[model samples]
Target chain A: MPDLPIILAGVINGLLAGGIYVLVAVGLTLIYGVLHIINFAHGSLLMLAMYAVFFLFKPPVGIDPYLALPIVTGGAFIFGYLVYRWLIGRFNHGRDENILLITLGLSIVIDNAALMFFTGDIQTIDVPYAGRMVELGAAFLPVPKIISFFAALLLCGALGLYMARSDTGKAIRALAKERQGARLVGIDVDKLFAVSYGIGIACLGAAACLLMPTFYVSPTSGHAFVLIAFTTVVLGGMGSFAGAAVGGFIIGITESLGGLLLGEQLGQIGISLIFILILLLRPSGLFGGKG
Target chain B: MSRGTLALCAAGLLAAILYPLVVRGLAGAGVGVSANYLINVGMLVFFVAFIGQSWNIAGGFAGQTSFGHVVFFGTGAYCSTILHVTHGWNPWLAWPVATAAGALVGWAIGALAFRAGLKGSYFALITLAFAEVFRILANSVEFTRGGLGMLIKADQRPENFQFRDPMWIYYLALALCVVSLAIAWQLTRGRFGARLVAIRENEDAARALGIDVYTEKVKVLALSGAMCAAGGTFYAQKYLYIDPSIAFGVDKSVEMLLVSMVGGAGTVFGPLVGSLVLTAINEGTRSLASVVPALKNVQPLSLIVYGAMLILIVARLPDGLMGLFGRRKSGKRHDA
Candidate 1:
C-alpha cells in the first residue's frame, strides 16, 4: 500500500474531481427532472463555459477566473434558455429519443465547431494560482483544486437550498415530481422548464470556472467527462438534487482511491466498474428511491 | 409484405447488386469519380446499412435504443484482427470467433442492464458507458497494440480476408447488406418479429400477454450483436486498420443510431434508405471538397452536414426516408 499522506492527497484530488462531476450532473438531473429530456449536450455546455472562461482570461480581457464565474454562469443560462426556446421546444411533445438525438446532434455541432475554431489544441488559462499549494498537515493540496472543491460545494449547497426553498425552485421540484400536478397548480411549466434548463447550464458554467484552473479544455475532453457526469447523475438518481451531491463526492473518491490502489488506467476501469455496479444494484442511485 | 413493397425491395436489391458493374465500367472509361464513389460511398452505404439494420433488430424492432452498438462492432473488429494478427489465425475462420465474442459481450450487457430494470435513456447511457470502458481498455492494453492500432498487411491473401481489388471489399459489404436485408425481411414478417415489435410497442402489455420480454430482448440483443460484429469484421479487413477510436468511437455509434432512425426505425427497409441518403450526403460533400479545394481546409464539414441532417430528420422526417416510400396507414400498421 502507498503512504497515508499520498492516499489522503489522492482522496482530496478525487473529491475535487467529484465536485466538478456533481455540479455537472446536477445540471443534467435538473434538466431531466423538469423538462423530462436528457440534455446530451450538458457537457458541451461545460465545454462552452471552459472556452468562455479561457477567452475572458485572454490578454484582451485578462479577468481573474474567479471574477469571471458570474458572467459565465449568466451567459450560459441565457444560452441554454435560447436553446430550449429555439431548438428543444420544437420536439418537446415527441418521443424521448427525439430530444436525445437533437442534443446529441447539438453536441456534435458544438464540439466540431470548437475543433475548427480552437484547432483541437488543448487550451488552459495560465492562472497564477495554479502554481500555489496549501499544506493540509497530512498532505498538500493544489490551491486551484482546493479552491474549486470548496466553490463547487458552496454552489451545490446554494442550488440545493434554492431548489428546496425558493418559489421557482419549489415549482421546479413540483414539476419534476409531477408535471401535470405542477401544471394544474397554475405554474407556467414551459417557462419554468426553460429556466430550469438555464439554471442547469448555469451550474455547468460554474463547474467550468471551478475546473478551468486545474483542467485542460479540448474539443473531445467533454465527451469522457459527460459519460462520468451521466454516471454520477444516474448514480444519484435522476432529478434527485441531494442524491447528485452525495453521488458526485462518492464517485470522486472512488475514482481517486481507485487510482491510488490501481494504476491510473486500471483506476478508470474501476470507476466504470463501480458505475456499472451502482447502475445495476441500485438503478435509483445512492440517495434515490424508485420513481 | 404487400406485393408492391416486395417488388420495390427486390428492385432496390437488384439495383444495389448491379451498381458495382456500372461503376466498374464507368471507372474503366476513365470517368474516375465513379471509382471513389464505388469504393467509398458504395461500400460505406452497404456497411452502414448493415450496421443500421442489425441495430434495427433490437433498437427498432424491440424498442431498445442502444446508443453504444459500436462496442460490439469494435469487439468484432478487434476480435478478428487480434485473432488473425497475434495468433496467426485465418481471418475467414475468425468470423465465428468474433461473432460469438460479440454475442457474448452483448448478452452480458443485455442481461445486466435488463436484470437491473434499466429503461429508456439510462439503458442507453449504460451501454455507452460499457463502450467507453472498452475503448479505454483497448487504448490501454498491449495485446490490442493500444491506441497506436494494428494493421493487416497486403501480403495476406483472401483466406486472411485481404484482396488486391478494392471492389472485393465493396462486394463483400454489399453481399452482407443483401443477406441482412433478406434476414430482416423474413424476420419482420414472422411471429418472432411480431413478438419483437410487440415488445417495442409496449413492454408491460407484452409481458402481460405472456411474451418473455427479458429473454426476447437478450436474444435479439445478442443476435444483433453478432450481426453488427460481422460488419465490424468487414470494416477491419477492408480498412486493414483497427484502433480503439475507429472501433469504438461515439461517432460510429451515432452513425448506427442515425442511419436506423433516419431510414425508419422498426422497418426492415428503413436502414437501407437511411444509409443510402447518409452515404450520398457524405460523398456529395466529399466530392464538393475536391471541387472547391478550399472545402478541404474546413475539415469537419462532413460531420457538420451529417449532424445537421440528423437534426432535420428528427425534426421533420420523424419516420425517416422510408416514410416517403410507404403509405401512412401501412407504415403505422407495420411499426406499432
Candidate 2:
C-alpha cells in the first residue's frame, strides 16, 4: 500500500480536479433547474468557449486567458441566449425528450463543426505560472489548479449570490417552481429562460478560461467532461447548486482514488458506477429535493 | 395496411432485391459505378437500419428512449468475439449465445431501471452510465485485450461465418432487416405492442387499464437487445475485429437514434428510410468533397446535416419523414 502522504496527495489532486467539475456541473444543474431539460450541448458549448480562449491566446492576439475571461464569458452568454432563442426555444413545444434530442443534435453540430474547423488537434496554452506549484500539507499542486479551484469556488459563490438576490434570478426560480404561475404573475418566461441559459453557458466560458492553462482543448474534449458533469449533477441532485458543488468534489476524489487503486483504465469506472447507484438509490441527490 | 401501401412495399422490396444484380450488370457493361462499392453501401444501409430498428423497438415503440443502446451491441460483439477467438468456439454457434447474452443484459437493465421507477431522462442517463462502465471494464480486462482490441483470424470460409463474397454479408444484412421489419410488424399488430403503446402514452393509465407496464417494458427491451446483439455478432464476423470504442461508443448510439428519429420513431419503415437518406447524404458529402477539392476534409458535412435534420424533425416533423409518406392520422396512433 502507498504511504498516507501519497494518499493525501491523491485526495488533494482530486479536490482540485473536482473544482473544475463543480463549475461545469453548476452550469448543467442551473439549466436543469430552470428548464427541466438536460442540456446535452453543455460540453460542446464548453468546447467552443475553449476554442475562443485558444484563439485569443494564440500568437497574433497574445492576450492572456485571464484577460479574455470577460470577453469570452459575455460572448458565450449571448451565443447561448441566441441559440436558445433561435433553435432550442423553437423546439421546446413537446415532451421534454424533444429538448434532449434537440440539445444532442446541437452538440453533434457543435462538435463536428469544431472538428472541421479545429482539425481535432489538442491545443494548450503556455502560461508562465503553469509549472509553478503550491505546497499544501502532503500535496504539491500546480499553480493553475490552485487558482482555478479558488476561482471556481468564487464564481459559484457569486452565482449563488446573484441567484438569491437578483430580480431576474428570482424570476427564473419562480419559473422553475411553477411555469404557469410565473407567467401569470407578469414575468417574461421566455426571456428569463434565455437569460438562464445564457448564464449557464457563461459559466462554461469561465470554466474554459480557468481550465485552458492546466488542460488541453480538443474537439472531443467535451466528451471527457460531459459524463463527469452529468455524474456530478446527478450525484448532487439534478438541479441543486450546493449539491453539485459537493458532488463534484466527491467525484473528483473518487476519480483520483479510483485511478490510484484500480489503475487508470478501471479507475474511470468509479464515476459511472456512482452515477448508476445514485440514479438507482437516492436520485434526488445528497441535498436535492424530490426528483 | 392499405392496398396502395402494400403495393409500394412490394415494389420497394423487389427493387432492393434486384439492386445488386442491376449494378453488376451495368458495371459489366462498363458503367461508371463500381459494383463492389455500391453493394457495400447497400449492405451498410441495411445494417444501420437493422440496428436502428432495435433502438426503435425499445425507445420508440416502448417509449424507453435510451441513450446507450450500443451497450447491447458491444456486449454481443465482445461475447461472440471472445468465445470464438479465445475459447475456440465456432462463431456460428457463438452467435446465438451472444444474442442471448444481449437479451440477458437487456432484461437485467430493464428490471433494475424499471423497478427503480426511473423514467424519462433519468432512465436515459442511467443507461449511458452502464455503457460507460462496460466500456471501462472492456478497456481494463485482460480478456478484452485491454484496448489492443480482439481480431478474429481471417479464415475466409462459409463454415467459419466469414464469407469470401461480400454479397453473402449483404444478403445476411438484408435478411436481418426483413426479420426486424417483421418483428416490428408483429408489434404493431399484436396485443403486446398495444400494451407498449398504451404505456408509452401514459404509464399510470396503462397500469390502470391492467397492462403489466414494467413487464412489457422489460420484454420489449429484451427483444430489442437480442436483435441488436445479433447485429453486433454479424458486424464482428464481417469485420473480423472488435474494439471497445467501436463496439460501445456513443457515436453508434447517436446514429441509431438519429436514424429512428429522422425517419419516424415507432413506425415500421422509419429506420430503413432514415438509413437510406443518411447514407445518401454521407455519400453525397464525400463525393462532393472530392469534386470540390478545396473541401477535401469536409467529411463531417454529412453529420452536420444529420444533426440539423434531427433538430428540424423534432421541431417540425415529430412523426418524421415516414409521416410524409403516410396520410395524416386523426388521433395519437401513428402506425404506417
Per lDDT, the best of the predicted structures is 2
lDDT of 2 by residue, A80-121 (tens): 999989988777866767788889999999999998888988
Listed models, DockQ each: 0.54, 0.64
lDDT of 1 by residue, A1-291 (tens): 999988888888788788888889889888987788988888877898899999999989998889999999999999998889888877666667667878888887888788767778888888887989888767677888888888888998999899889999898888888989999989998898889989999998899888898888988878868877887887888778877888888889988888789777667776577678888888777777764
Worst 10 contiguous positions by lDDT, candidate 1 chain B: B327-336
Distance (Å) between predicted and true CA of A20, model 2?
1.2
Give per-residue CA lDDT, model 1, range B1-336, as digits (tens).
779877977897788778878877888988755575567578888889999998888887777888899999999999999998899989999988999998998899999999888876778878888988898899889899987999877665766688777677778888899888887877767888888878777789999999999998898899999999988888898889989999988888988988887788777778888888877777677677679976664666667766776687778776677767647422232321
TM-score of chain B of each: 0.93, 0.97
lDDT of 2 by residue, B73-124 (tens): 9999999999999999999999999999999999999999999999887888
Per-residue lDDT for B53 in model 1? 90
Cα lDDT over the full model 1? 0.83
